[model samples]
Target: MSSPEQWTHPEPGEGPAARAAQPSPEQVIAGLRATTEGGAELTQLLTPEGERVASPQFDRYVADIDGEALRGLYRDMVLVRRADREANAMQRQGQLGIWVPLLGQEAAQIGSGRALRKQDMAFPSYREHGVAYARGIDFRELMGIFRCTDHGNWDFKAHGFHPYTIVIGNQVLNATGYAMGQKFEGKVGDEDGEATIVYFGDGATSQGDVHEGFVWSAVYDAPLVFFCQNNQWAISEPTERQSRLPLYQRARGYGFPGIRVDGNDVLACLAVTRWALDECRHGNGPVLIEAFTYRMDAHTTTDDPTRYRLSDELEAWKLKDPIERVRAYLARNGHADQPYFDRIQAEADQFAADLREFTFNMPEPPPERVFANVYAEPSAALDAQREEYLAYLSGFATAGER
Candidate 1:
C-alpha cells in the first residue's frame, strides 16, 4: 500500500536493526500449505465449487459478463488447455525439442489475457501459450518455437503480443522499458491510453532483472502490469523457498499497490486485470498482480517433477481445476448443457488435431533464414556471410548430384 511519497528513513533501532520476528520452520510449512486456499486479500469472484462470489469493487468491471461472455471465457480455457496438452504430448513423441505445459494455470493466463485492450501490449515468458491463444496468435504459429524450427514469426505490432522471452525474468525489463516509452510518448493518461502487461512465473521474482524493472517502472510511473503467476514451484523449489512474504506484498516497497487474486477463478483474473489495466491507462500505472495458482505438470517436458514433489500435492490442486469450475457453474445455472459441453470438447480436440498436423508438416527453414532478419536495416557484412554459407551448402549438393 506504500507509495513513493510515503518513503522516509526510519529512526535508528526502528528499521532492519529492530530484527522483525521470523516465522518458525513449522509455521512456514503451514503457511505454504495454506496458500492453496488463497488468503483474505485475494480478489475472487468464483469459488472452486462453481458458486459465484460477489466483490463490490471488482464486480462492476465484469458487470458485462453475461452468460454468453462467460461461455466464451470457458471455451477459451478449454481450447488453450487442449492445445497445451497436445504440445506436451508431441514433445514426448519427439516432435518438439521440449514443451512448457500450461496445464493448471489456464485461468490465470486466459482471464488476464482477454482483459487487455487491442492497444495494450503483452510481454511473456516462454510458458504463455494460453495468453498467445487469447491474443489471436495462431496455435500453429507457436509450434515452431517448441520444434526449434523458427523464432516466433508472428506480427507483434498487429497482435500486440511480443515474442516469448526464455531467459526467466528478462521480459520484465523489456516490458518496463517499452512502458516507459509509452509514457515518454504521452500515450497514457486517457481512456484510450496504452498499457503493457508482462507475464512471469513466481520464480522469476528471484531474478535481479525483475527487481530492476520494478524500480524503473515505479520511478517513471510507466503503464505496466506485472502479472506473476505463482504456480507454487520454480522447477524443483517451492514458493516458500522463494520468498518469506507473499509475492504481491513486495510491490509495496517498490511504491505500488499489489493485489493477490484467485488465479484459478477466471472471473477474478479478468476483473482484477481489467481494474489494473484501467488504472494504468489513467496513469496510476505499474500495478502488480500475484495470481495464486498451481502448476500441475513438470516445469517442462525435460523436467522430472516426481523427483521433488509428491502426488498428493497434485491431487489437492486437481480438485480446484480451473476449467471444471466454470463447466460446473455453466451446467448448474443451465447456461450450458451436456450437448454444449460435448460440442466444446469436440472443438478442442479438433484444435489439437490441427496443431499436431501443422507440427508434422512444418518444413525446415533454409539455412539463410537465420541471417534474414538479424538487423532491421541492410548490413553488407551479414549479406556477405549469408552468401558464403549458401555457397558452402551448394557445393555439398553439387557433389551429391555428381
Candidate 2:
C-alpha cells in the first residue's frame, strides 16, 4: 500500500487545451451548476427515508415482488447485519485475530445475493460477509479462516460460492476463467442455465488483474458480472486516489455496458443484479455494476479509521443506513410490525450465540495435519520430510516421554 501523499489527485482544470485556454467566470459558474443539476442518473430505487423511487430499468422487475417478498429482503439485511456486528465484536474480543466488517453494505450484498439463481456461481473477495450469508454459508465457517483454525470450511462446489480470495484482484481473473470455461462447456444460453458474478472492492479495481479480467471477459464474451463495491475507502485510500472517472466507466471502455447503482438501496441492487445476470445468461456478454456504497466500519479489526478519516463523514453515511432504511420502509407500509422486528432481533442474537459457541470449541488441527494434504499422492521425499519433522517434535519432549 502506498502512502496517502503518493496517491493520484485529479487535476480540477487540467484537461483539453482548448477549454483550458480561457473559461470566463460566468462559464465556470454555469458549468458547476450543470454538473450539480444534471449528470448521470446514479440509479436509485430506494431513498434514505425508505420511499420507493421510480427507476425505469428496475421498476418492471420489482413490480411482482409483493409485500411479503419485500419483508423477506428486509429480514435478510437484518440477519446479515447482526452476523457482521457479532463478527466485529468477536474480533475485538480476541476470539479471532482479525475481521473485515461489512457494517453498512448489507443491502448491496443481500440484494445481489438474492438475485442470484441456484445455478449461478459467485466469486467473492475477503470482505463479502453478506454475500457469504446470502449463499447459505454458515457465518462460523467464515471465521475459521480469520481465526487460523481452518482452510475453507465450506464446500465451494456444493454452495456455488468460491472460498474468499484474499489477494486483491486475483478472483476477477478466476471468475473470468470460470465463466470462459462455462462458455466452452456449452453452458451459455442453455435452457439449463448458469452465470457467474465476481465481487471486488474499489481498491481491487486499481490492480492489473481486474483490468485483465475485464479484457478477457470482453474478448470471450463471457457471461460474468463484475460487481465493484466502491465502499468509498479502500483501507484509508479513497476512490479518487484509484481513478479519475467512476469505476463503472472502465467497463464501457472494454466494450460492455457499465452501470452505477445506489448500492445502499437493496431494491436497486436486486433489480440491477437480476438484469445483469439475465444479460449474461442470454449471451449478452459481461456487465459491470459500480455499487456506490460506504464502508461504515474500520477496514478490518486491525485498522484504525481515526488515523485517516473524519467522524463527521461516517455520521453522514449513517443517515443512509442500509438496514434501517429497509426497516423504515417496512414499518411505514405496514409490511412489518413490532413483533416482527422483535423476532428478527431475537433470531439474530441466537445466531451470534451459536457462532460464539462454535468458534470457541473449534478444534485445532494436529501438527501432522499440515503434511496430510500437501500432495494428492505422497512422494518418497515428502515421507522422509514428514519423518524428519516428527523426529524434531519428538526431540523436544520430556525425557520419560522421549
Candidate 3:
C-alpha cells in the first residue's frame, strides 16, 4: 500500500495538463456516471437491456451456455435474491443479529461461482449468498451464522466453499496461503490443475492484508484469482474515495493482469472468470477481476444508505437490474414463457418460506459455545475464561425464580 507521501498530488492550477490529469471531485463523480454503461474497458457480453453483445475473445469461454443454461442462471439469481430479501426481513423482525444483503450483486457472485470447478476452492466475503447457493451449500446452513447461532458450521472441504469471512480483505491472505500450498504441491500446469478464487469488495483494496496477499501470491505465482466485487461503494464512501485509478488497474503494479467486467452481466463475469482460472491452472497465476456492480440495499440492516447517498443513484442502478436483464433475455429469445417465469417466482417464494421457518425454529445456542472452537487443543487459560463467563451468565436469575 502506498503512503500519503508516495501519492503524487498536483497543486491547484499547476497547469492545464496537470488539471486534466488530476480530476476534480466533480470529475471523479462524473467518472462513476459512465460506469453504469460500463466504459470501453469493461468486458460485457450481455447488455442491461437484454441485448447480446459480441465478445470475440471471450465467447469461447461461455460457448456451452445455451438458452437452457441462460434460464438456469436466471433461476439461480431469482432464488438467491428471494432468500436475501427473506434474510433482510428476518433481521428487521429480530430473527437475526444482522444481515448483509447481496441484492444487486447476484450476477457477479453467481456467474463467478458457477464457473468454479469441483476441484477449485472459493473464499468468500460475508455478502456472498448467491455464491453460496451456486456452491451447492444448503441455504439453511447459512442462516445460522446470521442468526448468531453458529460460526458457519458448514463443511468447507466438502462444498469447496470456505466459511464466510466477516473481516474485509482477510480472506485474500487466507486464499493466497491456500493457493500457495496448492502450487507447492504441484497442483498447477495442466487442464485439471486446481485454482482458488478469493472474493473481496472494492473498499477492501485499502487493507494492508490485501496488499500483502497480492505481493505474496505474485511472488509465489500462486494459482489464485482475486475477485473484487466493486459494488461502487464501500458501505457509503464511493470508489473514487478509495482509489484514483480503477481497482482492477491496481493489479498491474503487483505484476499481474487485471480486467474489469460488467458485474450485472452474468455471461461476461462467467466468461472472464473461466479465462482467469484457466490461466491460473496452466501456471500463469494471479489475475485480478473487478466486477463493476452496485449494492442496491443498505450496507447492512444496521446502516442507512439514505443518510449518505441519494435515492436517485439507486434508481439509476435499478435500470440495470441484474435479474431483470436475464429475464428479459430469456423472454425475448422465447427460451422461457410466462408460465416458467411464474413457476420460478412461486418456487422462490416457497424457498423463502422454508428459510423463514428454519430461522424461526432455530435453536438458541448456549453462550459457552462461543469458546468451543477458539482452539483445537485444550487450553487452561481458555477453560478458565469460559468458566468465568459461565459464572457471570449464571448470575442472572430466571423470571420464574424471581
TM-scores for every predicted model: 0.93, 0.87, 0.89
lDDT of 3 by residue, 39-85 (tens): 65889998889999999999999999999999999999999999999
Q: What is the C-alpha lDDT of each candidate?
A: 0.90, 0.82, 0.89
Runs off by more than 4 Å, candidate 3: 1-29, 366-402
lDDT of 1: 0.90
Q: Which stretches of candidate 1 lie over 4 Å from their true place?
A: 1-25
- Candidate 2 per-residue lDDT, tens place, 303-389, comes to 999998778768878988888888898899999999999999898889888988888888887777667656678689988888899
Candidate 2 TM-score versus the reference: 0.87
**Which segments of candidate 2 are over 4 A away from where they belong?**
1-39, 371-400
Q: Given candidate 3, what's the lDDT at residue 213?
A: 96
Candidate 1 lDDT by residue in tens digits, 44-87: 89989999998999999999999999999999999999999999
Candidates sorted by TM-score, best first: 1, 3, 2
When superposed on Cα atoms, how far off is each prediction in RMSD?
A: 4.7, 5.5, 4.5
Number of the top TM-score candidate: 1
Itemize residue pairs with steric clashes in candidate 3.
none
> Model 1: clashing residue pairs?
none
Best-performing candidate as measured by lDDT = 1
